[model samples]
Target: MQRDKFLKEIENLNHPNETLVPTHCSYCAMQCGMNLRVNTSTNKIIGVEPRYDWPVTLGKMCPKGVTAYQQTNHEDRLLKPLIRDDASLKGTKEGFREATWDEAYDLIVKRFKELQQNYGKDSLSVYGGVSMTNEKCYLTGKFARVALQTRYIDYNGRFCMASAAGGINRSLGVDRGSTLPWTDIHETDCLFLAGSNTAECHPTSMFRIWAVQERGGYLIIADPRETPIARRADVHLDLRPGTDLALANGILHLLIENGHVDEEFVKNHTNGFEETKQVVKEFTPEYTSQITGVAPEKIIRAAELYGKAPNAIVLFARGIEQQVKGVDNVSAYINMALVTGNIGRPKAGVGTITGQGNGQGGREHGQKADALPGYRKIANPQHVKEIAEVWGIKPEEMPEAGVSAYEMFGLMEQKTIRSLYLLCSNPVVSAPNSNYVRKMLKQLDFMVCVDFFLSESAEYADVVLPTTTWAEDEGTTTNVEGRVIKINRAQKPLGESKPDWQIQVELAERLGRGKYFSHLKTSKDIFDELRRASKGGNADYYGVTWEKIEKQNGVFWPCKSEDDPGTPHMFLDKKFYHPDGKAKIFALPYTPPAEEPDEEYPLRLTTGRVVYHYLSGNQTRRIQFLKDMSPEPFVEVHPDTAQKYNISHEEKVRLFTRRGEVIYKVKITEAIRKDTVFVPYHWDFERAANILTNPALDPISRMPEFKACAAEIEKIEVKKVQ
Candidate 1:
């Protein structure tokens, strides 16, 4: 009774609290639903926690979600529009001059029109940043199609999920919507995670995998390094980098030899089974083991576990797709799922995990090189007609297929792409081959960047338009699981910064394209238009509207009608989008890395993310706390290699590749493989990993091999201070 009275008295204490509003995570594509508890009295977000009712996130969010509010308050945020006053020269006295929104929009319109008149529309390229909301993405696509009449439009997904989209599009008829019921992770008896480190990257989603493993279910982890997930896995296969296709094919071979395949499922639900089987027969365990570096017996055991398990989920990430053989690797994994009857059902399918925050949502709304809204292929006559009618333009006017991201940069170097309008992306630090990207930027006649910060790439911009961050804006985003969520405005725009859509719309109107850039008052108007475009398409998101979403936490796509419940998982039935209602299977083969270590560079360098920082350190690096924890970039070398080279921990080391060299501190550890060294690529100055990265790209996807690059490392002796 005394304890109860004390608790009641504590609860009754008069303390002001903020009004909590519902929102979505802005960090990654997971788009975890969250609640922003704002201090109404102070006009600041005091706390952020997950929304319990959302089925996808399930009240789980990563650290990035909880701390996203910091981005709004970060000192480095650009609060006003900046225009370059001096000439466009690198390291020049050309600093940014603050401009009003009207001035910025007017100048942008004048330049775009001048460029169009001077050069063909094909000469202008528009690159969308995936972090923008679906509403913003819709407006961007509209601007490219209706205003500029430029078919040379694409998003950053070409760098992140191109192979996943391309390979899946060829086989399953739809590029990027999840075929793997993601929520089915709870029901999965065995989870095979390849190339992804869930614990560090997708922390909240890993709960499902952890639950399965904790219940005596098996978890197979395949990666070059012994990541946190790999250490906790039931079976860890440290396969060689860029050899994922070999292992996937070997697994299929084992399943075929052991007769573990479901013939009935294959015959009823799939096509190309006979040819797939014949192809797998040649990829014997012995043959693949030699290439993938996995023992034949171990491959058989891994296959048996996956094939025999009642429910199995195979998840892949950029580690498999950011390679010259990325398309092949994705095909090999998808083929395994089809052969073993692991798809089109709950808890069993091929899952392609995206890297960027809004990669899925961005692509879903016509942000790809060869795709329009709703995952519709530009080559398809029907798809082209549908989009053409919606945009009030002739289908024939659209470019057959614009250049991919890698090709776009290559064209910039060759002087084919003279002008570029970059929205929300920092290509200087994020794109592979950092030095090459920097040099190409210098070659461009005009480059415009719209972002919240003066990022690494913004340094070369002829014009920089300050844009609002997530906290200062209102929009919607989609998660990795195809779940759509909203981003609520918790505060006003920082100084002169405006929402991305507003800036683009304002510019479009100024350029006399007001008809296409109409309905710019609110995000709701833009979202309603997106819904109209999605009607009857592969990803029908008609069920959701601004009114409906505001009343609830969120809704997933394929909500085609008013009474329809948003789709939880796609492709639950055996029916596919193909003509015959069957998914095609492609046989993928392993291809070596673009650059291989030789006598001059006798080591392999692998680049990846750090726990504290995100890609290129655009936002996270600005945080003093995060920066303090990870002050400088460092190279992780194995103990044996470090000892052989007489390198000590914290000692400066020079790493050299064919392209360039960088110096970083040595971090000797057993976690890294013997001949391989691990380096975080987020740093800008001391050791930019992209400087030494391979620029070779996948044939089908056009994504460069940012993960695997050949290099050599040596200890650099410091001279004694005078």
Candidate 2:
């Protein structure tokens, strides 16, 4: 009956004048399957329909996914290359004039050459984002090292997924986002979600999360705000922001005291348990409550629920991973699963809720500063030699590793990195301490932005190259589940805009680096090279051919050869990737936020996404429906805090931190901690939450502290018009 009903729904979506092109949503890592309705006569995408056949998000589409098609044909799209004639108008949208591709490429080459000749090759830098296909990301690393010959190449994932990557890699010795597939989520006996607001951020996955509860399984959440998912959780540990380490340790202590430790698993499959136990022994519930501000009883209850479950999965997102101790927080949570022996099997493991579309594949294929393709370290000589062999360059010619994304801005401030090639990101709105980021961008000797829209960051560029949307490009992206799925092209490039891969190829030729890139004429050509480049490394994809992806719906990696079916459940044999074939349990110590609440800034401030917006609101803000749903940013304040500050609901208030300040309309709600305020970081300019966010970097991941900072709200006095 369900199959027949699904067939009927598909039949109703069919139209004689339109052809349905199957693909995945170009938004979050859920990568919900969808079919783009393309007008056959015009070769343009007209609408979108949910892909009921796709197993990950069967027929489910979030508002962003439903309106994703609108981005390709939107009026705000950059139709031609833009050249800024006046250097004085760098931070505004006033100086750009439409130019041909030749003029734009010539100007970029001339400026880049002049900068490199004047101040060494390291003057040029590449700032990338992970929203693109794996093909584009792989080529981007090659483009920077081979063509540009620069050591200052980093990506936006530094702010989003770096901590999760660092933590998972340290604990399990491999970072695949999720150990068990999304299909295993519903069957899990318990779920301990830390810092993720799955209901709004990845709405399509809610069905599976809710299904766990429908089966009488327990759900535990740890967050500062009572998010939609937290409201429904059996236990909500509303800990103070930046205190996830303490809360996780508190739970670990109880798990040990209550005799929940799997002694056999700890003795065999893991190491460092004795040291970890020693560290957590002092993290009693009362002591932890003093640090995290979550009740002792709540912490004990959460530990009991998770420890008692036969099969459980631990998951987290930016909330815990966007702090100074982000990596520690991640490992602390994974410790729970490791101690409970709830990993290395079906329906049990640890995973992260990936924030971007290709967060999994993008990080793997070397967009990061210190990473080579296949999660290989650039610092390792053998890894450099391996990648150099594929690029046909001598190993010595490869540049050394660069700094993280935010640190690149620091280099720019010092005039070390004079030029920047920015793509797939809007740092002006997304980066922490964005006011300083914007200032540094304006001071760049040469700046180029490649994006479909004129983002806030693009407004500061000397040249803006038009790039095609996802619907106009064909490639592969690994979903949050680490499944490599093919994204089919639904339409040709509208106007003169080109795909980012083609743009880089053309740019490389102009810069006299054609031999390394000219052979890649199509996305498949690039993917074929990428597959070989990724062979034998941790994120091996040599066997994951386009044909295989199409045949299997999607193929999970570390697929080594053609006959290999791919790994869906990681560490199935209980063999970890560490040298000793054992997962590590770190003895992490608790740490406070870089900037805690003080006399001047007396409240905790945290930032996150809204259902109506993706990162930075570059694409979604242009869609009328998404814009109408969330027109501006607001600060969520507890009623008691609002009253104390003499602020009223919907009243404009000044929310200021040590970095900067923004005026937001008050949204009084008891869903948030009385001592904390929440702001969605989607809007740009003065409304952006990044303005108030701290730029303190995590020691291991170099992730900026976006989730917690000291802040204070002031009631704005409106003067009468008279």
Compare the candidates by lDDT and give the number of the best one.
Answer: 2
Q: How many backbone clashes does candidate 2 have?
A: 0
RMSD to the native, candidate 2? 3.0
lDDT of 2 by residue, 1-722 (tens): 74786575467466677789999999999999999999898898877889999999999999999999999999998999999999999999999999999999999999999999999999999999999999999999999999999999989999999999999999999999999899999999999999999999999999999999999999999999999999999999999999999899889999999999999999999998999999999999999999998988999899999999999999999999999899999999999999989889999999999999999999998899999999999999999999999999999999999999999999999999999999999999999999999999999999999999999999999999999999999999999999999999999999999999999999999999999999999999999999999999999999999999999999999899999999999998999999999999989988789998999899999999999999999899999889999999999999999889999999999999988889999999999999999999989898999999999999999999999999998888988998
Cα error, candidate 1, residue 326 (Å):
1.1
**Candidate models: Cα lDDT each:** 0.78, 0.94
Residue range 1-722, candidate 1, lDDT tens digits: 74786575455334366566777777767777777766677776655657887666689976566667778767887887777876545523267788877777677777777787787776678888788889888788777767777777887778888888777777777765466546778688888888887777777787788888777788988888889888888777777777788888888888888887888988887888777677777778788878777777777778888989987888888888888888888878888788888887877877787677778778877877787877777889999898888776788866666878767888887766777888878777778878888888877777788888888778788788888888778877777866677788987787778898887777777777787667668888888878878888877777887666666555667789877767666578787778898888775545678777688788888888876777778888777567777777889998999999998998989997888899988988887788789888888843688888888888888888987878898678778999
Task: For candidate 1, give the lDDT.
Answer: 0.78
How accurate locally is residue 412 in candidate 1, as Cα lDDT from 0 to 100?
82
Q: Which stretches of candidate 2 lie over 4 Å from their true place?
A: 1-14, 720-722
* TM-score of predicted structure 2: 0.98
